[model samples]
Target: MSKKRTGVFVCHCGTNIAATVDVAKVAKEMAGEDTVAFTKEYVYMCSEPGQESVVQAIKDNKLDSVVVTCCSPNLHEKTFRDNATRAGINNFTCEIANIREQCSWVHNDKAKGTEKAIKISRSVVRRVNRNQPLDAIAVNVTRRAMVIGGGVAGIQAALDIANAGVEVVLVEKQATIGGRMLQLSETFPTLDCSQCVLSPKMVEVKRHPKIKLMTYSEVQELTGSVGNFQVKALKKPTFVDPDKCKLCDECTAVCPVVVPNEYELNLTARRAIYIPYAQAIPASFTLDESVCLGLNPIVCGKCKDVCEADAINYDMRPETVTEDVGAIVVATGFDLYGQENMGELGGGKIEDVLDGLQFERLCSASGATKGHILRPSDHTEPKNVVFIQCVGSRDPAKHCAYCSKICCMYTAKHAQLYKHHVPDGRAYVFYIDIRSGGKGYEEFVQRTMEDNDTLYLRGRVSRLYRHNGKVRVLGTDTLSGQNVEIDADMVVLALAMVPSKGTTEIAKVLKIGRDKDGFLAEAHPKLKPVESVTAGIYLAGAAQAPKDIPETVAQAGAAAAKVIALLSQATLSRPPLIARVRRSHCTGCGMCVDACPFIAIRLENGKAVVNEALCEGCGSCSATCLRAAIDVKNVTQLQIYEMIEACLAV
Candidate 1:
């Protein structure tokens, strides 16, 4: 090979790195290398002038490769790449050495930090020397997007993406599109009716021509990569034709079978043939085959007989559908942490104790008690109600360690709602600390305390038990330094928000990573909050973390924006870095196939072949090949050896 020509540029990053590390000394050390054609220092390498200088040097010296020593590559790698491209050098020939975060911020000693920076630059230089010019391969993009989950987040994302003129497939696991948001009575801070606000979006999703709303459906399998994905969804049988059904209550009134309504948290009863609620999006009825008497042995067919529109069908079977899309949005939302195992909090055995969601149902106008705040054990109204915050949150010993972000604000809202309903009722909120970080949230909490006369105590509810027609709560007031006791008529626990059920399974299907707490992992917590590490797949709402309504909607919009951007491209450019297999060294052990997480490799004609379009350049197959038959296109064994040698060079 011809002699290598390298250019190095070090950035001060506006005193972020210059304050600790000597930028000029690091640049001078890099220039000492034999192949170093040019070296320079700048206050901000990402600035237009600095980039132009690097481009000018590459042209002036006819340099083949460049090294930029600056902040983390995550921040400015694209800027430097664009600079190299504009300067007539291949973008892949440029490498970035992070000195700001890895060297300066972490180290206190200036000399040591400078040494580390020089070493990092040397390794990058060696790596760039082995780099070859490569072109980004083009793949056709499908102008469509898929949204999982039918909650507020999913609805928002589907609407936004569809509004951008891209076709959207919204797959909902429930019979209705509205998820937990429909169950809520009134939203916090604004006090707007949850259904009133969410119902309009639900209708829009159902009516939009570009949006294909699939309720009672779930993603069974996901295959392919960004810009071209095949998703198979299983549509569960509702046993009632949505198109033919008139959504009248005639069938529900005549059905003899009665079951607990899950939407009401089992506090109310509904017929076996029923709709989720009055404002259900499709305006259709669903027959629960499990509870219906007509399905097995045919004891009764009253619902089918009573249907005026003749929409009942007991023989309906599940159907699977496949869709092609360019991008996917995961807005599966969250589930409240269960208190069944929390024995200290009465283990949900107390007659009048309930979770936040159940309380929300009770406060709703369509609830069992007609929106009256009555104790479940009796039909009478409760004179005293106790609200407990952080029941399953911030308690690493028993539950999750992270704070359930919405609990504090929602608990305050719950207190205010209760006060509004029962003028003579006394509401007591026990909390470790109030976290009202949203707009108007702190003032809303204050209104609950002062205007509504609700009592806020700083402490945790240690225990609860039924005593003489009242719930006895035992805990201490940390602020007052006093042991406290209360005999309450009802109790509500603000359970932690956990990633919804089957989220992990879905993540596995999509080949996406999740944090230890089971939430989908973002590419970067700050910069790439909405994008998942997996390309073309985005996250929104509580699926990523516990976020309130406004935040969830904003994230949904952000994910939609990413989808729109992806769909806008006429053809997507697949990374040039991908694995390659040598047919001559063929020992079709198939081990590499199992090791390939992206499923980009397969055995054909007794030799392994790679699907370059599907490959993510992860290099797992290359590492697993025992006979050295596989090698990643740009990253090879020789490059790694050269980098290590350069790092250890005296």
Candidate 2:
């Protein structure tokens, strides 16, 4: 074995390190080492001139490996690797030692910072000495993307990715493509009709040449990794053929069985065979086999008799589709916190007590009351309505601790919309604090107060019950220090927005992570807000966190851009740092099989085998191995010991 010649470069990072640590001293210390061929210090190694100098030093010193003491590898690891590659060295021969963030910024004393920087650099040098030159593994990228969920976020992502010349498969569990956005009557700030803005996008998704719309479908399994993901989606039967069915209401009119319309939040009744709403994208009806007469037609078959297109099919069964996609965008949207959880607020027992979506129905022109804004129990106008904010939110003992981000603005919007429909009606709101953090959001809240004369009380309701045929809300006004009581005709609970049902399950299936609050976890909360820890998978909308319409749309577009960027690449170059199993030292105990977090290790031919593509180099398998059969590439147990010795050395 020959001695490894390493080149070390220290970066000042424009006083980010120089102000706190001795960069030149660290470079000089590394130069004194026997393995170091040369050392250099620069103001910014990431700068063009600095990179040029590094390439020049590598060439002049005939260095086998390069070590950069600078910022985190996340920022400029690629820059130095490409620098090495340009200088006729394998890119994997380059290593990064973070001094600015890990050493200088973390320490206040100059001596301590300089000492720590030198130790870190020495560890990198030692690690580089053991590092063998390797080539990047090129994985072919499939030129297609898949989007789960059919909300505004999912629709936007699918359309954007599809328009970018990449095929997209858009899957929605519901019969229609539109999510919660379709149920709303109006959106905030501009008061634009919700469907007016969303319907066009829905139509575009259906008509787009690159998009394959799969409504009434769900992803059952996700396999493989980035650039080559295999997905199995189960598409439930809608019974009515979208291509064959005409948009006539003949079938719905002839059907005698009426069930509560879920789209209207049970505020209205629809025939057993019906479309969700008038603006449903496919313009097709779906037969509800659960409530409809029977599959055999022995009980009733009125809908089949009235169908002009003969589109009714009782034998329609669920179909499974297999899709190969390069990337995935998860925009599963959110579900409102259930009213049953708010036991203090009548527990949904009071007839007039409604959730936010139910109130949206009352204001909608197509609602059962025909936009009358009447109380559900009495079918009469509520002269005084009470709106409670954070019904199941910000209550750590009973509900969530985080604020339901959109409640304040929507609550104000609801007040304004309520006022618009009923000029004579008065609205009062109870809130801990109003969080209106968006363009024109504060102004909208102000208008609700000043223009609509909506009363704003800062507090929480302790109890709610029916009194004298009206809902009585008992709570304290914290600002005024008064125990206020209000007997309102109707009460609307601004329920907390929770991650949509099956979010955790879907995340598990995708092998992604979720936060404590059940929202999808981003790779980095601020930097990589869209990408998941799992490569090829991205997140959008309230599925990641509680966000309003504008934010959700923006995130969706950002996610689409990420997908397009991934699909545009002909082949993806993965880092050489992956796990390898030494077959000679193997004792097929299968401990690593269970200990591996990524499930990358498996027993093959009575020996432990590793799938390099699936391994993230987390070292969990290696740590669990007793015989030291597992070792991560670019890293070794000897290098770890040398690093520890370097840190402890005087």
Candidate 3:
């Protein structure tokens, strides 16, 4: 509000910005301005020494505001903020001018780039004068966690939080918790028994004193911020008593209605009322309400009549549960892209074509085919099976641009599993690349190639057609750069791994960011991989990105560590950079109110009140208001305009 006393620091950026623009000339030109307290330039202004210039100027010139003309704010805003705080200046008093990425990175002409940089710098100075110092609103965390999707990731997260002496609520949409892992016969590389490794985690989550496993449940509404969140979980009726039933197979064997078994990937017949698999967590049976006796009541309660536990609750109704939590881990995992189309690939049109998970089940000892590589059309063992990879991945033109990171490894694993099961069975794997990049990953691929007698052909299939009880595959060999065709008794498609179906829903509820492909977006790729853009919420497993078991487990640990870090604090302090409106300025015209994005602005005491929790410190509200009443603390309009006046000599 007083005289404009400004300082500008231009970064050489090691020729990133310096090569095209004259940093020293720009600084000197700005220094000539009467309002400018001082102007300086340096190489790597983001570097330690460059930051020192800002602090030194703030003290030496008694500057009222600071502008760091560097790269994008997204990269190092926090760094500059911390520097300002260290200098006894309000962190928001500083503003970052994007002269590098937006100007130097895009423009080649020296003078034009420099001119554009000045314009941006001037705009920021104009904007920052309106900025005011705002404090971050810190709410007490409940110290409880919610994990979505009770697969391995959820199980691991729940166990970690529970083990740490905190409460965890796990929600699973399915009636069981095993997820696709239970469907698999063996895990890759080491080929360890899938259930053997997964079952222990599931049991721990179910039995944990601090963990509440809610199967057949969906999160209907998620509200509040990271530390103190309230979630409404919808528990759909399973029609069977979870407490009474002891996982006896009696109900399934005698049920009158028989349908295709989804657990077997629908390869065999199963009663309508049945458990997903033998090793299902909770290891209990579920009644398919659509076909079960009690649904219409027209049919008989044969399952209940047969059950000695009287576990059947015919009057069961969907229930809603509200739980409070301090943090959340969205490890809902993923689902394989359903290859229902690509009629040429025999996706849903043919009987013998199966996805990777289905094939996993078929290869398992507890599977429909009893660990035999058999044709679902007739239950006969197949002598030859063709594996198709990248069904709906890596092609932006068709399915998705992402590579679905786990597909290549899992397909190789599938081929290896097929070879192991049917020793004499010929396994031909069609792939785009072998992406076993993690620990023991490369060696695993080599072992599969050398020991399994599996044929690895690098190519993409053009078409597939079932003829004479066999599918004829037409493809091109990328290695040989030649067209190839083959007929196999059965075909296994390694479908693309995709984010869970409820990913978008969860993203909206949690307010955590998500990229275009539906995978949860992290705050920063390298620096904050496990953290979501939203604080107090962490992500792990395939829900965030397509990751293998080892990576998923490691991420689970990282997420747990983050929770522990948050809990470690004796008293959380909200950073003093969030937005707040001046209640006394009082012209409730509502222009600033409409501009607030996070709904952090509220009508409190009959006036427009800016909620510290909702404000992003973006200063959008300050920009739109005609009255100029809105101020984003520290980086206020007065200080920024002073900086601008200093820069322009106006």
Candidate 4:
């Protein structure tokens, strides 16, 4: 047996630590430890020169392990580990002690802070002494990628990945590829027709040779790991065969079953046999099974009989398809905060008061009223329309505490569009604050107020109710310190943006995490915005957070680039820090299997086995093992005990 030599490098962090702790004394004390062969203090241990100094110290002192006591490992652990590898030592032998965030930053006394820093550094040094050098596990990759959701974000991600010479399977939960964007009339700032901008991309996705378009589909099960994932998806039957459905309107006219059209936000009626819109991708009709009489021939078969092309299939059933992919992008998009939750604002009971999406439908050219800006209650043009911003957002007590980022700009756009439709009509906007923080956004809001003569009231609406054939809005203007009331012909609520339906279910299926507000959680808020906690899966658009089209597209492109970079490699190098079972202590209680969140462990022949590819090194399995048979490599129980002893050593 050979003795281990450890080197300790303490960082001053340029007064971030030195201001509160004695860096020189801490380095001097660390040199007295048994395994520490060398110790030094630097102004910034993460700097290029500081890293060079560490490399030189390792080679000069014949050190086998290194510990860098500095900032969080998240920022510089990899840097120091790479430095160790460059100096001809195993990267696994390098460890980080977070002295700045955990010690100096939180402590006011210099003696206590320095003592805590020493304890933290000594704990990591002890752990590193016992660390065995390990190599990264390599796994072969599949060359395909799956993108969930067919919104703008998903479409852009799919196109980018496919353009990079990788195959893509694009899945949409709707009958058509276009998502919520297809239901919009026009976009903000530029005022371009939403469909006009998105239709071309929809066409491109359908015609791309490297892309497989799967509409009316949902991911049922996701298993496997990064570089090789197995996916089971359910392709829901639309009944109308897309290949044979000639976009003729005969079936819709003959159908007796009429349902509220979801595409129009239920502001209009649609036949059970109908297409989403005129320019729907795959351009076919979908038979609604939920509302239809029956799929059997004995039930009313009006749609099938009237179908001249015989596209309607009575025997259509959901088909499960399997796919193997290296990576996945989740761009499931968003849904507005339900208007039914707003009880004070009539809880969707007021006929003329509508939510933002419904207003978009009313303003759309292909909408129910043909872009007339008519009130839904009477089908007449509104004389005075009131737009309320931040309906269920930024209200911590009863609703979402976070600001819906797009609400302010969209509400301004709504007011501007209303003025465009009714030239002589009045538009009033009630808002907490105008948060037009994008390019040309502030100017657009200004233009709406100055040019269009829209009155902007700075306040929150207290109550809203229908009175005397008009929607009455009662609010207080905080800026003016006055009570304001308006009996408007129509009112629009700028509801908050929430994660689209099935976001939570999909997060559980993919083993990804979600934030407190229910959007998918990123690995890091700033550095790894698009990357999910799960290795192979990425996030974009409102599924991750509230964002507009340009931001969503940019994030989608970023996620695609990450996927491309990952799939471009012939094989992926995964961290070797995974669970390992000790066969001697075998009692295969299956407790570890039940506790493992990643499903990385399984009992094979009454012995617990670990799948290295699936394990995230979370240590949950190790914690659950009563016999202490299971442990994560490099983070074993012995190393943890030594580190804990070192920490408590006075």
Candidate 5:
């Protein structure tokens, strides 16, 4: 019940705060507060000497609590708290008042800004007065990691984690692990064969002892918290046993059902029993259950009969497998914007017109026309090709407002590849502006324009439609102040990259957030790009935003390193600032459980119980509790009330 000793430190932040708010006046006013035994103003409180002064004052004045009035706590809260710990005071006793972002930055009036800064500092001082010493909560770790998605990002993350001696569970929704990256003929900049670079990594994932690759599978449910998570993954049956199947083509030859091959982007037909590609991991065949004739022996038995290895199993059913892991990495990748939505362009209706991926297929050796750049409608080589960029990007009125970062570079790569295939072919590109912003990317685009003689027009295409045997492109050349028209044999649309359908579904299952554009949201865009809002969860590749291959791989490796660091810990230290339930306040209506987003609250023995490890200290449970029995540890209702009173005090 004795009076507490508090110290207040105001920072000038090199005119960031001093320019608008009078730091010296704020410090002088805080010194008059009853509990404030020490007060100081520093030019830069976050600098080494500034921090040393704070620690020295705490020691000399015997301060029990401290408040630092400066920039956002997000940037320097830990620095000041560590200083408190260094000076033998409890770290929880230190608090932050964001005078820069909340006060100075927004206001130009010096007098009003100083007045507001004083109020902010006084409010934090009141909050820190009631702050109690608390220790970090320690939770046991599972020492394993799960990576969702089987693209280059997922594969790289899994491989990196596995290489570090941590067990990995890799789940893929498709029949194979290659994802969209495998479907491309060549990558941008260097123009290396996509398969040749990625296939080796896929094979490494298949052979790695520490990695358990689960293809034709999906994560159905995720439960538990950071250091301990239970994942229920539904492994759909492929109907062809991987171990028993031979690499022979006899079964696919006899299958009667023919469907559009997804790997070929429907540019080719495939049988009911087929392998994704010759270099598919596991080297097995898959029976497309959706399009196949009834799996009954009386209905369709040709594939079973033709399989000399007897690998076909008609009675196979979906099985759910459970995995326990400490951390999870989401690398769900991306999908192109649906072509059906582009009615203004000849998309999904015109055979010769294709999206970027389909064009890559046309250039692929294993594609429908055997690497020939022939028009799909007439099966003849296209003498003229038109490439359009920003088809569904940077058009705030109708499409995505943000730029699809890879489109500009890839569009240039597409033009260069087209010219390479057909030496005499004329290539035209219609774009708003070029955004080739990577190492060697700008040079590559220049080479394509100068060496390949590809014409770059600064304009937006108005409309595209089939005219006679050729497709007519209607657009304007803004640089030339002229309207332009082209009768092209083939037109390629560089559709915007969007979060895949699976990425959306998985976000809900993982209880993570998605941005307005539907990409997974990072915890902090600059400092914590790979970390998701949820603890123990990380993001990589286009699932976060549209990015190129090199960036994707780099992010994947970074995510893997984070996982390795998390799992390597013997016990994880969670923030002690989680919710706590007051058992004496009785009624357990279970409302807190429903209101909790992280699934951190539960009713036990007809009373609310909070799992400290799972709680994010968001105060949702406390707000939903009508009895006021639940509260976050450090940010209690009493502290909030006292802080509000101090802010209102004239």
Candidate 6:
């Protein structure tokens, strides 16, 4: 509402900014401009006395606002803000010119860099002159979280949060909570049954008073921000409602329609109205919408007629349930690459070919053919089995340049499993680099070779094709420099790991940015790996990158810690630099609203109001202001403009 008696402090940053730019020349140059009280350049403006210098200058010059031309605001905007605020000026009155990263870090020519830095300073001064005093906003955190996946990571997150005495909603896309872990008979190296370790946790999740498990459900839409997120979950009609269905098989026995069971990776058949598996959580049966006579084509309601509990609802339609949560952990695990992604690997075309997950399901006792590995084409067993490694992953030529870290271990596990079950089965593995870098990982792979009698070939499988009923794998052994071919009863492809197809969807929903590969981008690669670049949001599991079980679990725990720490605060503090609306001058064209991926801006009392919690203060919204009506606090155009005018003092 008032003009700030602004002081501008330009940082030389020890040649990081000074070497290319004539810092003093530009500082003097900008001091000659109007609205510029004084301008000076210091060797290290972010240092202790350097920061105090700005505060001293603010006090000495009787300045209400200060501009510091230094590194990206991401680094030290807050430092200047804090210094200015402590010096009896509003923190938002301190504007930062990003000369270091945007100018000096990229540009080599000194004169050009100095000129560019001055221009940037001028822009920030111009923008900040229109700044206003804004208060931070906070909503009551519900002390609740919604975790979308029920896998080990999700389960761990739910258990931790529930144990912390917070309400948790654990939603599973499947009928059970164990996820891919349950598909495995035993974990590598430890040789412990996956279900034995996971079932107790699953049961604990079911019994936890603070935890609500929503199985066979999907989150349809997510609205709001951290501490105030509203989610709508579409409870796909299971036909057999949990409150009424007793999980009895009487209805399944009478159902006429049967299809290849997805639970068994399509190696077995399930009735049209079948429970996902014997130990399906909530233990409720689901009628297949595609095949149920009544629901499928509106032809078969046979399972309903014979039902004693009257659980069948033939007209059951998708229902939406909305809940408020303080935070969201996107544990929506991952799906293995299907036939569509593995065209070069002879994926669905071969009856015996399977992805790593399908192979796990195929070998389980609950799987099709009852744990006897056989070709789907003929159900016959053979002596030779070949495992193709890096099928869809780790191929730079295919855009999967980075290794999917889990493939090597899991492929090795599959080979050992085949060897264990087939007794006389010969298991051979082809690979490029064996990345068993996790704890107990190298030994696990070694044990598979030594103890399990599995052979490992260091190379790639160039091609795979079906001959007669069996598939043949052809590749070269890089170690021996020999062309190798194997005809096998079954061939398992360790498909490449890519970010989930929903990665982009989650990014949009969160209003966070993602890289070209679609995995979540961290705040910094080395400094802040678990945290997203967007404040108040954290990342976990394969959603962040390709990781094995251990790494994924560890990241999940890290994400939980971040959430707990954030919620633990009495109230969160945001950066003083945020986009502010000039209400009288505002047109409310909604350009800023549309441009904001975070949904930070909304109409309040018919005028624009920015939810400080949602705003990232990226200045994208300010740039979109048609009338230049929107200016970011502290870093307004006038402040930047004057700072530039002062920097280029002629």
Highest-TM-score candidate = 4
Is 1 or 3 the stronger prediction by TM-score? Answer: 1
True-structure RMSD, every candidate: 3.1, 4.2, 3.5, 2.5, 2.6, 4.1
**Residue 329 displacement (Å), model 2:** 1.5
* lDDT for predicted candidate 1 compared with the true structure: 0.89
Over 4 Å off, model 6 = 1-63, 104-111, 296-298, 573-650
Clashes of 2: 0
Give lDDT tens digits, candidate 6, residues 18-49.
88888987688668656678787899998898
Best by lDDT: 5
Local accuracy of candidate 2 as per-residue lDDT tens digits, 1-650: 69988999999999899988999899999999889989999998898899999999999989889999999887789899999999999989899999987988888999989999999999888888888889888989989999999999999999999888899999898889889988887889888988889999999998999999998888999877799988999988888998899878898888888988888898778888889988887778899878887766676778887788999988899999999999999999888998888888998888999999899888877666777899989789999999999988988987988898888988898999899988999999999988887899999999999999999999999999999999999999999999999999999999999999857668978979999999999988788999998889999999999998999999999999999988888899887688888889889999989998778888988999888877878788888889988888877666787888888774
lDDT of each: 0.89, 0.90, 0.79, 0.92, 0.93, 0.77
Question: Model 3 Cα RMSD, Å?
Answer: 3.5
Residues 352-390 of candidate 4 have per-residue lDDT tens digits of 989999999999998878888999888999999999999
TM-score of 1: 0.90
Model 3 spans with C-alpha error above 4 angstroms: 19-21, 32-34, 133-138, 253-260, 269-272, 290-300, 478-483, 575-606, 609-650
Worst 10 residues of 3 by lDDT: 128-137
lDDT, model 6, position 247: 73
lDDT of 4 at 449: 96
Predicted candidate 1 versus true structure: per-residue lDDT over 295-314, tens digit per residue: 64367878778888888888
Query: How accurate locally is residue 623 in candidate 6, as Cα lDDT from 0 to 100?
Result: 85
The 10 consecutive residues of candidate 2 with the worst lDDT sum are 292-301
In model 4, the runs with Cα more than 4 Å from the true position are 14-29, 100-117, 584-621, 624-627
| Model 5 poorest ten-residue lDDT run | 339-348
User: Residues 437-478, candidate 3, lDDT per residue (tens digit)?
Assistant: 877878887877788888889998988887888888899888
Whole-structure CA lDDT of model 5: 0.93
